[model samples]
Target: MTFRKLMIAGAAVALLAVGATAAMAQTSAQKALIDAAKSQGTVGEQADGYVGVRTNADAELRAAVDATNNGRRAVYARSATEAGTTTEIAAARMFETQLLARVSSGQWYRNAAGQWVQR
Candidate 1:
């Protein structure tokens, strides 16, 4: 792999390790809501390292998305600072490596081009 690819891969592995701990920061209820929304195709991972609502979202779903994105922003900010990179780059990397890879079959995710596609 190219040096850039290698760096990203390494960072991805690091992020994955960090993710397990970070996930514990979220409540079980929050994770359940997001997972349910994802499974139902109402919410999806976005290229910006945030969750997007793909269809009409109820108040509860919207709140859950907002909470999840807020947590993601904090993680990306910390990761960027540690890596000496911008938050956007850190988030994009996480999206490419972590979020995309986590998408279950038949779930939806928004691509870098802002298009929603099902896996």
Candidate 2:
């Protein structure tokens, strides 16, 4: 990545970690839903810092993901505004630069090319 991209990615990661302190907490059930989806390779984290369902999901699963992504977006938007960057930039940097590296095996993720990948 270019220098500017690297800087933005670093800022995004830092902001995410810091912002987690004030963000809405996820319920245990919601955490379980995400865990199951990751284990099942049905839902994955996208490069834009949102959750993506790679396959058909029941209503409950979809709802859970939607809620999670909405919360995440709110955090990203706040961070982006504070940093004087667009929300998409913050989100792209957050997930692509940090979250992707932490995804465990058997989980799905969207690559930089926007392809769904198993890692």
Candidate 3:
């Protein structure tokens, strides 16, 4: 494969490696809270709150992708590369940049600019 393709593959592997180490290791407090929510039928209620969070994150990612496409179209749209390299690469780069930069100590919320923030 090409160098860029190899780099992308390596990056993907690295991301998965790091994510594997990510503390899905829940604290007892957090696990207990989730359990209580599930038992109390509060999952639905909490989901109601999370619906906005989910929707907003999806919207932000979509917008970032769309914006990246528009920008790439004006620039590398004619470049002789992979079919989606211009747009998808840009979006993925943006997202990876965001993910690396935003995550911090025990953080759990998206900030106003769509970046992850500690809550």
Candidate 4:
């Protein structure tokens, strides 16, 4: 393979790894709360690669969502730097290729058109 092609392949692998790592970075408690909230239709994954509250959120749920988004932001920022892109682009790519794929059936996610969709 050409050196350029090899580098592109490596970067793609790294990006995928980073997305998976970010998804698993949450604490058990946070994950539990987020999962519960998602099941309840109170919160969902946003297309911009952040968590969104569909209804009024209590302190605990809100905190968990905040922590989750914070972790995602960190990952997106690092990936963006490595990829020579903006954080928003990195986040969108991660959402489309990685995070959105992990959404379970009956869970909620915001579509790119800002519509809340159930997976």
Candidate 5:
């Protein structure tokens, strides 16, 4: 094989390897959150009012803040009360904007396909 052809093949292989590594390393942090959420005792016994199971949501929020400019994002949810055909509800998104801001700046970016891809 020609030297030029060999060099091109080597470059392609290296690029593929780097891409694979990035994919593999793509956000083990989310798993960390899920594991924490599933664990017991983190929320404490007989806890009430948005209590979490194993992970501290506050700590995670703070961590997101710290991950500024690193592509971190926050997930949010709220409790709702639906009464009539038009649901009457109260919404609480305490960490919504902050989390999104963290995500906008952190290491979270979508791929060319518009799917979530790690940076």
Candidate 6:
């Protein structure tokens, strides 16, 4: 193949690989943090398409929440772009229709009014 063509193909491959990595499921550490946070009522899903602290948390827990929520925001931003909607609308729709179902009873979550409540 021509060098220019080869470069293009290589770029495409790299892009696809990055996309695949992004599509992979969350890491074990991430899962564990989220689980612990939920159980402890330290973090929970919010109506804004991201997770947040339901109550005060230690530094480690706070960091985990921040990481997870940041990841969620990136996803929400992409979904919003694809759906031609605002990020807040996209997040609210996901929280109301899908994310809430994953939350366990007694877990803390932010309701539509942004108030924290136990699920």
Give me the candidate number with maximum lDDT.
1
Q: What is the lDDT of candidate 1?
A: 0.83
Which tens-of-lDDT digit does each residue in 8-113 have in candidate 1? 5566566666667667787788899999999999999999888999999999889888887777777777776666667788889999877899999999999999
Worst 10 residues of 3 by lDDT: 43-52
Over the stretch 1-119, how does candidate 4's per-residue lDDT look in tens digits? 97644543444457777757876888889999989999999999898989999888999999999989998888878877776767787777767766798788999999999999998
**Candidate 1 colliding pairs:** none
Candidate 3 local lDDT, 43-103, one digit each (tens): 2111101201222233443444344334333332222133335444533443454333533
Best TM-score among the predictions, by candidate number: 1
Better of 2 and 3 by lDDT: 2
- Clashes (N, CA, C under 3 Å) per candidate: 0, 0, 0, 0, 9, 0
Off by over 4 Å in 6: 1-25
Which runs of model 1 end up more than 4 angstroms from their true locations?
1-10
Rank by lDDT, descending? Answer: 1, 4, 2, 6, 3, 5
- lDDT (10s digit) by residue, model 6, range 33-111: 8798899888888877578887788887777667766666666666556555565665666676667887899998888
Cα lDDT of model 2 by residue, 34-71, tens digit: 87988899899998888899999999898889888877
Name the 10 consecutive residues with the lowest summed lDDT in model 6: 10-19
Of the pair 2 and 6, which is ahead by TM-score?
Answer: 2
Superior candidate under TM-score, 3 versus 5: 3
lDDT scores of the candidates, listed in order: 0.83, 0.80, 0.37, 0.82, 0.29, 0.68
Instruction: TM-score winner between 4 and 5, please give it.
Output: 4
Question: Which stretch of 10 consecutive residues in model 4 shows the poorest summed lDDT?
Answer: 4-13
Per-model TM against the reference: 0.87, 0.85, 0.26, 0.82, 0.20, 0.74
Question: How many collisions between residues are there in candidate 2?
Answer: 0
Colliding residue pairs in candidate 6: none
> Of 4 and 6, which scores higher on lDDT?
4
Better of 2 and 5 by lDDT: 2
